[model samples]
Structure formats: structure tokens, C-alpha cells
Target: MSSIFKWEAKPFFDMVTRRQTLQAISTTALPALAGCTTDILDSGKSQTRYTLNIEPIEVSPVEHALFDPDDDALFGNPAQTALAAILPDGRHTTYGYEPLPDDAYVEYEGSYYQTTNLVTGRKQMERTLIRAEPLPDKADVPNDAILVDELNRPAARVVKILHSNAVTGGEGNSAELLREDAYVLRRPVERESRLATGELDGRIVTMTDGGNWAYRLHVTHKRITETAHTTLAIEVANSHSQFRDVVFGSRIDVELTPENLSADVRNLLEDAVRRETYEETVPLPETFEALLTALGLKAVDTAVTGKLLWYDGELYRCALYVNDSS
Candidate 1:
């Protein structure tokens, strides 16, 4: 639920006059309105039908991370398992050794060694290395080398070596200790934007998936005898509804005024204004369809133009305009 404040409606007679001039030109110069007669003296009077125009809206982008760092398959150590060899009769021959693959290089004894002629059980479950060749140093290892842990499993690629230290073993042999970059093995962030447009009950509606969410334009017309009425409803919804409770707040302030309108048309516009204004707090609806019902705004036979201001908190967000003349 949200609070709505009602304010006095102000008129913009200049815009109304401009709309009237445009309507006159559209009716006379355009073939669509041909055969329509307008008496100069009675031009101030309202007529029966009007036109509706819609504009395109944009949505902001959202970002998402691609990986979780705590997964065991990417971060766990595999050096605890014992190496074994598979016999021809399915007997197991266990060996006290690291399970590295043949030709695989590793930084050992302060140098690099390439294993060769590796012997292993089914599915490489047990590995027995025949021999290894000495390499110059870690500097010789390729940046895109196939990295593997002690158990011969795939290891995350190292992006950058932050720090390195030499560790002395019980036999006085030295090994390299490396500090890897934090972003190594992590995928890049992805940004997404979603947009949709459709017609609902003759009204053109466009939706944006962001804080400034929905934009809707509705136009309707009715005719009676020699008089005609046209109504335009411009609706905007922010992301503060029930589905987007994190948006904090949203507000829409609308103003409408009638210019050079006949007595009957003026009365109709006044009634529509009264219906559109809210004097009590109302529950903020989730969907635009529910929002229209909550706001009590409906299309009626009237001649007027409207100005709309949308906001979130004290910041001015968006604006929409409607010009109706008959």
C-alpha cells in the first residue's frame, strides 16, 4: 500500500489553443477528415472523436555474477589420495606418490618436471608415474598450460602470480609457493536489458524492466448528434508496486484543463477530473491493469489536454503529455 496526495489542477490554455489549431488543420488539410464541416463561429464547440499517439520507452541494464567461489570442484585440494596402479586381473597395486599425468609439468624442488609414461587404474582413479624430466624453472611453463592438481584433476587457471616463496622439504629439497590473483577462474559479469510491448483492450502499452517501469497511452472517442468528444489517458507506473517493494516510493501528478469548450463539454471534463483525483490513501497495485482501477481513471467523452509528472521520492523522473481537441 502507498499514499497519494491530491493537488489542485492547473490549466495550460496556450497548449489547448495550439491543439485546437492543429486539429483544425488535420481535419481540413488531411483526407482522413474530409467532408467534415466546421463553422467558424461555432469552432469553439467540442466535437465527437480524437486521435491517440504513443512513444517508445527505454529500460535500464542489470548485472549478474557468473560463478560462486566456494564450490569444491574448483577450490578443493586433491593431494590426500594415494596413487595406485591397475593390474591385469583387476588387482590393485597401491603406491605412495602424487597422482600426476604423463608429460604434465609441475613446480617441484624449486624447478619444473615433466612426467612421462604414466600408469593408472580405470577412469584414471589410480596413477603411477614412470619417470619425470627436469625443466629449467617455472619461467618455462606456458601461461595457458593445462594445469592439474596432485590428483590429476583439472585446476583453475592462474591469471597472475601475486607472490612466490621457496619451501624447504624434509630432504632439503625446495618447492615454490604461489599466491594467485583473486579474480582467477572467475567468469565476467553480464548485463541484461528486457523490453516488451503489446495492446491491451485497444490501448498501446509498453513495459520497461527497471526503476522507471511502465508507460501507457489510451485514447477513446464518442459521438452524439452534431457534437463530438475525445479523451486521452496517459498513464505511467514506477517500480514501487507490490512486486517492486524495494523502490521506496513512486508518484504520478496529472493536470488537465479545458479551453474554448462548450457548456456540455466543460461539464464532462470537470466530472472526469473529479473522478481522476484521489482524496484517500490507496493500495499500490502490482500490474498496470490493477493500477488503472486503483486510480479510478476512465476514458470519457471530453475535450481537453493533460500534463503528467512522474516522480520517485523528491527526484523528478519522467513526463508525458496528452493533447485532445475536437
Candidate 2:
């Protein structure tokens, strides 16, 4: 975004345009690979290393169940499914860092409704949403359940659906995707997109920022035709606040698997990956477990390690996967 200083000149990265992005990975120091979509071909040299870690985020049992996503149970209907289709992987799956701060509301097309019968004096419960939120964040909202943000801008769909019968009152069940990994208002979707994700079912072991800036990467896996892409929704609260456009683009590959990983780490990865097929929001296998972990991630991270290398002279971003059919 800034012209006064170039990315290759500086020690960090910034959001870059397609023209500004280079196809070559410069190697004055560390042996590196090239391109955002290219496979990692550098065979490990003096590349910058970042260790992947996942710590437990504190939450009440009730809160955890309410906010966390379900792995096995189908979490959406036709409307919910339609809306989720437009989301960029990590946004729908990424957990909220904060508990929505109470008083806050998201755009929701879903709500609890009950109908009463005049003759029998009976009540029936149902869940429904017609069109759904327009933008990935929120665009032209046609649903009454859709919500708006502080600026009255359209926001993510968060619905508290109710279920009950004519006899019982109702119970609340929410189908929400708390996509707060990035600053939705300040850094809108237009400027950012999912890059790559390196995940394992249990623990994630990959490269990090090497301790310059604190960042959170919400990795999302996407399959395009025959190519598998791991998109990273990188959210950073950087200490360096001068630059507004910061983009860390790179790839992530599962370097090691459970069979080749440390015994303790392997057990955790296997358990987390397998358990997800039937459940959601599991306990952390190990604090700061090196490598990768996430949904559909177990298929990628079975006893694995992840390595990331940034191009040119920049650091921060890491390596991800690209399924090579040939």
C-alpha cells in the first residue's frame, strides 16, 4: 500500500496488489521457493521459521457450547447452507476471541417462531430464513433476521433458533459463524482473502512470525477442481501500526505425519482428527503443539509437521499445501 518503502526492502510484509506481487523468491540468505500458488520446492534451507501453537481460550461450559461449531451434527438448513457457501473457509469456522461483548448483535436471517392454534389452543415451533445475508460479511440483506453493525454496515449471520412442541415452551439453539478474526469494519473483505491453511487434526506444528509481530492465522481448506488449497485468513494486531495494508501471503504443507511425529504429539493429533468425525470443540491436545490442526484437517495432518517460508526478504507468512494431480 505504501510507495515510500518497498516490501522487499523492508523486513516485513504488507497487503500487495497483483501487479506488485512477484513470481520469484529471492535467496540472498535462505533458500526459498516462489509464488503464492506454487508448491514448496526449496527442500529446506535457512528459511525463516515460525512455531505453530494453540492455547486454550477461557470460556464457560455454556458459552463454549453456544459459540463453538459442531463437527458431526449438521449445523444448518437450506438457508443457512446457502449463506455458508459464500464464506471464505476460516470465517465460518474460526472461533471468536471475545464473547461478542454482550450488547453486540450480528446479522441473522433466522429466529425462533411459534404458531398457536385457536381451536385446540396448541403451539408449534419452527426455524426458517428466506434469502440470507448478501455479502460474505453482509451486503443487500433481504431477510428480516439479518443484522447490521455499529456503522449500520451488514454483518455476519448469527441466529438463535428455537425448537419446541405444542406442549413444551422452547429451547435456544444458535447457528452462527463468529468471523471476527479480522477487523471486518476497518479491513473489509475487498482488501483481504483467504490465502492458505496448514492444519492437522490434533495439534499444529508450523512456522510462525519468529516473534516480531503477534498474529493469528485462521486456516481454511478449499478444493478447486483437482487442486487442494489451504487458505489462511491471517488476522494480526501488529505493534507496527503505521502501515494499514499488511498482507502476509504464503503456502503451508504438512511436513510430518502422526506416524513420524513425536509419540505424545501423534496421539493427540490422531485423537483430535478422529474425534471430529463425530463431535466438535474438543480439548486441546497439547499447549504449543508444533505443526497443524483443524477440521477436515486431520486428513491433512495425521502425525504431521508444517513448514512455511516467505519469499524475497520478508518473514511472517509460511508454507501451505497445493494438491498436485500430476
Residue-level lDDT tens digits of model 1 in 1-326: 01111312234344468677567545545553332333443466644332221111132110010111233332321211111121111122222222223233222223222233323432222111111122234444433332222112221121111111111221221112121111111111100101011111122111112212111222122221111111111112222232122122222232123343445544543443444431211122233223232223324233223322221112122211223333
lDDT of each: 0.24, 0.25
Model 1, which residues run further than 4 Å from truth?
1-45, 48-56, 61-244, 251-326
Best candidate (score: TM-score): 2
Give the worst 10-residue stretch by lDDT in candidate 1.
187-196
- Output the TM-score of candidate 2: 0.16
User: What ranges in model 2 sit over 4 Å off?
Assistant: 1-53, 67-296, 301-326
Enumerate residue pairs that collide in model 1.
47-228, 47-229, 48-228, 48-229, 103-115
